[model samples]
Target: MQLRSALVTGAGRRIGREIAIALAQGGADVVLHAHTSSGDETRRAVQQHGRRAWVIRGDLSSRRNVQRIAREALEKTGKIDILINNAAVFFPTPISALTAQEWHTFRQTNISAPFFLSVLIGRQMYQQGQGKIIFLGDWSGRRPSRNFLPYCVSKAGVSALTQALAKAFAPHVQVNEVAPGPVLLPEDYGPEQQEELRTRTPLQRFGSPYDIARTVRFLVESGDFVTGASYVVDGGWLAQGHDGSGTSL
Candidate 1:
């Protein structure tokens, strides 16, 4: 099936940008979402790929905003064949400093937003008879490290959400997740820390955003029998039993 259009959240930078571009290269027009950034650069990149691009801005933490995002995206693009839930927030809480507000923020952005988007958009896809929904998850959801409790839990929710949506939209829409291990480390990570992480991975290096993006494309374009699956593109970090903790860094 040739994906005609895709909606990618947090497309302003990093992994989200790469996914947007990859979809464009796959011959799909793109709807780019950014919380704060204008996403002009990503828009231009998509256009360069000869695919149409639209920018939509909204704070995913609010249900109202998420509704607006879905409404506006559909309004701008007559139909959406793909939805990539790539927007997320990560921070160190260390358990000791974990606050209700921080927890709420993580849940709202990391889990709730995606869930709402999937439901709203998935319904349309179901009516249309086919659609693809891919969530950008984290490897930490499997074995969460210390100091990032809320973020990890939220990601875990994504795993469940993927399955639930797969069942809910069964026989029509396909829902899956791409959990990245150590593609882009935090900016504060030191060189030594980076090297340690790289050495721990079986591949002995960090995976690129393209790794995740290509996997997403495969699911949308080729994985006809796939649904409720989690693709980990971590370069074997999880295989080594490494704890992806950020507090120590």
Candidate 2:
């Protein structure tokens, strides 16, 4: 088999950008998806790597858009061998201030989009007899960080979806989740908060988006034997436990 093509959502920037470039470098053509980000730079990167790259923009908040993406992408480029659900809505939604719309947005973006995208692509892969699906989860999702309640809940759902879909897709499509710890900190993020993440990590260091991207490439190239498993690239933050003893995610 000549290498396969991949669809990586949220490929406009950050980890998504890194993953798209990595996949292209590893010999996979790419379909870059994003809500607002045009992914022009990422597309150029993929093309520079000598793989064909296509850009598809749509808001993940709309179920229709999510559903349309798989069909549209496949229509443009047949049989996506890899699907990476990397687009997500993350924010601190406290109970006192969280609203119904915010809750719905979290679920729709973080969980619903990944689930439906997997379903659409998995069906195609099933017909073709193979595929790889990866969902971007968060360490906080498994551990439940304070303030970021809904985002965590949504990611927790992603973890659940990965395991369930791995079984559902069965012998054809291998599904997995990549739960990142503190990969890329925003430029404005407080130094004090950075220390908190580093202190909590057993590796005693912050991770990079490249770390997550490398893991994504690994899963895509790992072949069809692995499924229903979540690879946490969190520098061992999760191994400590979530009962509020060591450090909050």
Reference-based TM-score of each model: 0.97, 0.94
Top candidate (lDDT): 1
Q: What is the C-alpha RMSD of each candidate to the true structure, in Å?
A: 1.3, 1.8
Q: Over the stretch 176-221, how does candidate 2's per-residue lDDT look in tens digits?
A: 9999988887556787878886776789998888999999888888
| Model 2 stretches astray by more than 4 angstroms | 1-3, 242-249
Give the residue spans of candidate 1 off by over 4 A: 245-249
lDDT of 1 by residue, 70-139 (tens): 9889988898989999999987878888889999999999999999999999999999999999999988
Against the unseen true structure, what C-alpha lDDT does each candidate score? 0.91, 0.86
lDDT of 1 at 53: 98
